[model samples]
Target chain A: MEEGDRLHLGSATLRSRLIHGTGKFPSAELLAQAIAASEAEMITLAVRRLHLDGDRRSELEGLDLSRYHLLPNTAGARSAEEAIRLAHLARAAGLSDFIKVEVVGHEATLLPDPLATFEATSRLVAEGYTVLPYTSDDVALALRLAEAGAAAVMPGAAPIGSTLGVLNPHNIRLIIQECPVPVIVDAGLGSPSDALRVMEWGAAGVLVNTGIARAKDPVGMARAFAAAVEVGRLAHRAGLAGESGEARHGYGASSPTAGLPVG
Target chain B: MTVGDLEVEAALGPEQLRTRLRASRLYVVTDDLTPLEKLPDLVQAAVAGGADLVQLRRKREPWAELVELARSLQEICRRGGGIFLVNDHVDLALAAQADGVHLGQGDVAVQEARERLGDRPLIGLSTHTPDQALKAQLLPLDYIAAGPVRATPTKPDSVEVGFQQVTAAALVSRVPVVAIGGLDEGASAIEAGADLVAVVRAVCAAPDPRLAASKLRQEAAAATPWRWIRLNGEPRKSPPGETVLELLARLGVEPAGVAVEVDGRIVPRERLAAELVSEGSALEVVHFVGGG
Candidate 1:
């Protein structure tokens, strides 16, 4: 299919293959520009402080809000109830039903609470919200989230905004290989190469914020990330050689598309 | 911007833009004539009149003054249940922490702006022609304003893009088009495919800006009617003669957990198949969800 073709996941059918982040940009305008440059169909935003329309410090104040799904993140919630409450706040504020469930109990690791995330996803999904939980690279945890009616599973590469890239490719591969829903490599992606690497491994998408927002040239970096994601997705569709079998003395350009390891 | 203390309660962040953006019908653009002190009052009036999206379009104001005004206006828009936007000046927008900014062709490049502002703020553009609108469709703008549908003295030098231009832009553009310039409180603009009708003089010039905005909102509604009833308070469209059971099936809602309420009365789950609903019938499909 062409790049403009619709990407169906659960209820949404988006055009772009990439998912961008709204956090960490210097200004809302810059974030908007990067998202446009990235051509990402969906963007993630944190759910915190109730923004009053005229509040100067509120980041939600000046958005143009036209296209794309606004996936609200439960970034500060320490438990499932707190996450769900914030989810409700997001919805009451006129956000869509889709949410990115991020239940972080530990401040040091900033890692998601597996139990909290699973609990939150179930409730949100039961409320008819499309839940995409951000979790560690645990295959079993990923399976549980998917079973709990998560629209998609988002596994971190390392930590949130760490720019560490994928910490464990093996688990990511397993999650993508087994999960019924789309698998997204979220957080800790530092560069276009990191995004391309994950996509090459058959991830449905990759979410990057710090990588693009903190880059020296955010706009240029945004464009580069967009190209990398496109090329990576295209490469995956075309077929890439995997480490499935023992290599012969010589090598061909690529392996057969059959065992390319798509779920 | 320094990282906000994550624990500190924040204004609803960027994700809420989608719903607010979609629900907004009238976007009131402020003009130079409105006094600095009165701008907040004018915005309040507009919001009272149902101006859900308001923009501060002052180009000649000092940066500090602009930022200061954005603070008060943002609060007013928030209290009024509307969004506040800056016209041009992305830097001032960032400093004031406004919701978004509207940039035209000669303003800051969208990419350059992206370097300064993050993605959460609303970023929109003004397009006068079909080509500009179509090209902008590829950009990361939330909405695009097309036309001076009727030639107005507001910016006499500005080219007038008739209703046909609005139609063309709407047909090709992926984002919402706010038909601007010379738009009166009428269904004409909305009927011509304008997602919103932005007026400056009509509301600003009016002695009662609130009443003027309300009239425009009524016209915009008449032009474009809602297609679906609220299902569980969310918009859902049901086909003619669609039974409650079918909608649940179509929505993929598990019947076991679903409870139906059409209009104001409850319809037992067993009798869901017998109930018929059309376009306007309200639906409250509640279900018991796990977790807190």
Candidate 2:
């Protein structure tokens, strides 16, 4: 198994392509266990302002954060200004400059504001922040972000925490094919199969948060997703047979036709 | 030698001068209302009290006397680390070796000023509307002054453009927008995106010019006059004089794994702190992040 491939993001190179988000987890213990089980070298945590006098401990306090690269996200920001401010606050708190630019436009759906995301990405990039913008499955916007100097363009397969899996494989495929920077499938994914499907479609990687965090057996699901990503990447690299609309090619048997007794 | 080359020879490049202009919060324009003999004291006091730039606007003074005063004021500005500019007199600015000249709508064309002054000295034009500010972008201008933000006796014939024009002009201006006219405390103008707030009576008419300038500077600093730059491809505001490294730090961005580009060229990481982010600069800061 040729597993020597590395994920080059901005300046850091990682062996594992599975990126796990620390959101919607049932408990700190479970979240920690799931993270360990997933084997993801990079994990995202949302940057939120701590209360003035609140006794709340950070979600990252107990975890051995040295094992993973901390990618702070501007998850709740609704505008470019807010997202840029949040990225700064995240860095001010001693987190790395690696920022996930997520500007939510629609509240109920938590759909990313593509315009704001792009705006934040550009501003953050201008301020020397590594920006990964979470946008919709719009290929053009993805390319635009890449051109704007996004480290990687994360086009959501579906809405955040929706668990609907890849809704537009065609668009995702186009994004992966056209984008100069790495195209990561983020959001709208559920189950290990969904992760595998995108990885097989030539995505650099997949970001799974709710899919594993909300599962009944989160640790088990994390392990499954890790394996799926690896296998899918291998399949893509090995070169799967091309799909065809013609029945002869679509339903063709793998066995040699000429050597068969019936032939 | 070209005027720009002279400026460079003087160790103040156009970019450096523009950066200083953008960082300037208080600009004191001398008035004919103040006595000629008292002008030097007023300028020294204002500069001491935090005025970043002082303009000699003695419209009625004789050329020789104006030149003498301009030379003295230029000395005061240089010693105080403040910019000295002549109002409407390119020759006076040249004679005194002033930092720049501020032009009015009725003064010599900006093209003519640039030709005479060369690219070295800063050339600021006074604009009354957003249209004028937008048009100023086509000229070789270093900055544009907008407003009489309030009605004043200095320009009684001209209507007060208000803070609205200041905001509009700031939006349209590719150069730094200086909000002028009847300004006392400059918080409102700074909030409206004016890079520097120019005043006549606010400091000059005050019993204590230094205290008045200091108060206005404090007020302007509180509101923070943000310099506009295209980041990524979007218009964004940054604090004036913020270096590439400080910008990253202010945003809580780590220097590691980050690349900074200003205009179209990449700024090496080691030079981030030295490179000042000026107005109308296009910067692209990039770094890696955790993604799929």
Top candidate on TM-score is: 2
The sequence of per-residue lDDT tens digits that candidate 2 reaches over residues A128-229 is: 988899999998999999999999999999888889998998999999989999888999889899999889888998889999988999999999999999
Model 1 regions more than 4 Å off: A1-5, A51-57, A60-62, A243-263, B1-292
lDDT of 1 by residue, B1-292 (tens): 2235423223447778756787778999998887888998899999999997899988787777888899888877876678888888887788878888889988998777766888888888888887887788667777888888888877889878798887777655556678888887757877677778899999999989999999999889777532345565544434445687876775565555334667756576678889886656777654221110
Measured by TM-score, how close is model 1 to the native structure?
0.45
**Residue B72 shift from truth in candidate 2, angstroms:** 68
Looking at model 1 chain A, report the run of 10 residues with the lowest lDDT sum: A49-58
For residues A1-263, write the lDDT of model 1, one tens digit per residue: 36564567666787676787777677766766777788777777764422111232434334544466777777789999888866765554334787889999679989999999999999999998989999999999999999999988999998988899888988998999999989988989998999898888788888888899899877789899888887788878777745445443456656576776678
Q: What is the lDDT of residue A189 in candidate 2?
A: 89
Docking class of 2: incorrect
In terms of DockQ, the best-performing candidate is 2
Q: Please give the lDDT score for candidate 1.
A: 0.77
Chain B alone, candidate 2, TM-score of 0.77
